[model samples]
Target: MSARSVEVRLVKSGRTKIRYGAELLADDGVRLTVRAPWAGEGGRDFGFVRFEPGDVFTEHYWRDRWYSVKEVRTGDGMLKGWYCDVNRPVAFSGGELTAEDLDLDLWVSHDGATVLRLDEDEFAASGLAERDPEAAEQAVQALDELELMARLGKLTDLLA
Candidate 1:
């Protein structure tokens, strides 16, 4: 099986002069969208990555997040899987989570779109609020993967 990589960078951090953001570097040099916090980190800093989810949650403030590789499954078969997440030490809802809160869950989709599944009911009726919000976005800029591949002299060879 073929594979790819997702490396998380401290685009945005508590220790940086500029506001924090996360960079998703695909194994193929595809960079996903770099986004700033709708809010911002309260005290967290540092970052880490894990292949599979585990009980290893960080209690201390971290400056970075973790990246996990995911397969890019296609109906035809599969291309490859490479993805990451900024919720390593899983971040909690930064503030009070309520139905009004715009919560987002990040996941890589087959169509190359960064999938954000919003849980309105959870935010509205549950205590999943008043916590740090996780940094969410697609592993790479969806529209740019192909463009980037071409620039690197790759795309054409990726045919099924």
Candidate 2:
């Protein structure tokens, strides 16, 4: 049979609403390989730094975890860095794949140095712990593991 592919959507969960962030494509099933679209905001400003809109990312996901590692690149194919999201593993159904971004993130620069941890405050304010304690704990654990991996320069291996 031919390989299966499904549309991927990243949803930002809010107190009373869900915001659609980006739409992409992913290989079907539990372990998904997603190709996320370039940022339409012309790049995202992380406060400390910014990524150009031309930057594209490829994400790797496992169904039983809390994070996904995304390899970021420039429009000209230059490797920018690796941006990882601490989120729910992923769920696929009805021809669409979805993931809940848990707010915490780890960014490892292309050279493997300059790792930046982002959005902890937002995560704390998210009330996720109160809503789903288990998932919140899992998300924190995932962030810790990702930070360790990025520090050890092992994140690049995920892309392969």
Candidate 3:
């Protein structure tokens, strides 16, 4: 099938955090994959990694899963790492894909030597536990699952 353009919206607290265009790569009822270039204004340096203009991201989202995984690569196609987001299940409609950020994330270095869990403080302060305990639990579980996958060298399995 021919690839189609799609707009991806990452939402936080009922607001759109980021929206960018991507090329739809595949969809199998439950999951959707898209490839997009770095959408940031300039470059973001996180000490562990840097996201610049030529970076490319192949992102995977699931309708039933509580997280999304993105494979990050350099302009020359060298793998940088995997960035995983703990989010609500994704929805695709009207040529847009939307997912709500749950404030938890995991990052695995390309060589699998570095695994970091991020945004725990933000999640704890988000009041999600008080507002929706079930979702908060699921989000924590999802982050744990992703970390395990990264440690076991099985993170790529999700892409397949």
RMSD (Cα, Å) for all candidates, in order, is 15.5, 3.5, 1.6
Q: What is the lDDT of residue 43 in candidate 1?
A: 28
In candidate 3, what residue range of length 10 has the lowest lDDT sum? 1-10
lDDT of 3 by residue, 1-160 (tens): 2349999999999999999999999999999999999999999998889999999999999999999999999999999999999999999998899999999999999999999999999999999999999999999999999999999999999998
Q: Give the TM-score of candidate 2.
A: 0.82
lDDT of 2 by residue, 24-113 (tens): 445445667766556445666776446776676677877887898888887788887888888787887665667778999988888887
Best-performing candidate as measured by lDDT: 3
- State the TM-score for model 1: 0.24
For model 2, the run of ten residues with the poorest summed lDDT: 14-23
* lDDT winner between candidates 2 and 3: 3
Judged by whole-model lDDT over C-alpha atoms, candidate 2 comes out at 0.75
Task: Name the regions of candidate 2 deviating beyond 4 angstroms.
Answer: 1-5, 14-29, 47-49
Query: Using Cα atoms with residue i matched to residue i, what is each candidate's TM-score against the true structure?
Result: 0.24, 0.82, 0.98
Highest TM-score: give the candidate number.
3
Query: Residue 51 of model 2: what lDDT?
Result: 79
Clashes of each: 33, 1, 0
